[model samples]
Target: MIGVLVTFTQNEKFDRSTLAGIASELRGPFEGMAGLRFKSFMLDEDGVQARNFYVWDDEEKGRSFFTKELVDKVTGVYGVPPTIEYLDIVGFVDNSGT
Candidate 1:
């Protein structure tokens, strides 16, 4: 499986309402995409940063969604650049269902 870990800082003016709107717009389409297993996102208000954890069936599937257009749109919203990292994981723990 492939994993994507993206970390970025939000603009000082970034608001929760705007973040919620963006998340709402992306949730459905992303979840429905082929080979997309799951996604988890979190924001650190004090640190003014955000992180996204995504699991995909393969590299192709992950790359298919992280296209330039999507990246541009997301960065535009944040008004800041992002640092993303891709990883290959050996295993994962699903504590939520337990």
Candidate 2:
């Protein structure tokens, strides 16, 4: 499995609520996306940051999804660039349905 962390910092020109709205609007597109296990949209209103965490079943898919084009596109949307980090997920625990 692979985990990706994408963070967008708030800037003078951008509001976090706009990003949150975008996330809400795009949630359905990601719901049944192939190779995507889960995605979480997070915001730190006090800290002035937006973070998104994605868990993917396929590492290649996870890595390939974050392309330069994607970064640029999101930068345009947020009015600031994002910092992306990729992790090799060794294990996890889930009890949501249990």
Candidate 3:
């Protein structure tokens, strides 16, 4: 499995509504996408940054998704380029569902 983290930093603090819109817009493209296991939309405690954590079936899927077009889309939405990091999933624990 592959884990990907993409972070966006803004010059000024972002509002909740804006964050909601961003997350909402992203949901359509990623949810149920092939080779994508999960994605979490997040805002930093300080509210100046936003991030998306992703778990993919493999590195190929992760790389395919985080492309130049994605960078353009993110920049268009949030007005900043994202810093993307990819990692190998070592381990995890999930108990959200019964």
Model 3 lDDT, residue 20, Cα: 89
What are the per-residue Cα lDDT tens digits for candidate 3 across 1-98? Answer: 89999999987987978888878876997768999989999999999889889999888988888889979988888888999999889997767785
Ranking by lDDT: 3, 2, 1
**lDDT scores in order:** 0.76, 0.86, 0.88
Candidate 2 — which residues are off by over 4 angstroms?
Answer: 11-16
Residue-level lDDT of model 1, residues 31-97, one tens digit each, is 6768888887667766577677899988888867788887887688666767778999798886878
Better of 1 and 3 by TM-score: 3
Candidate 2, residues 14-48: lDDT per residue as tens digits? 46568669888879989899999999988775657
Off by over 4 Å in 1: 11-14, 45-47, 95-98
Name the best candidate (by TM-score): 3
Q: Candidate 2: deviation at residue 58, Å?
A: 0.8
In what order do the candidates fall by TM-score, top score first?
Answer: 3, 2, 1
TM-score, prediction 3: 0.91
Model 1 has an lDDT value of 0.76
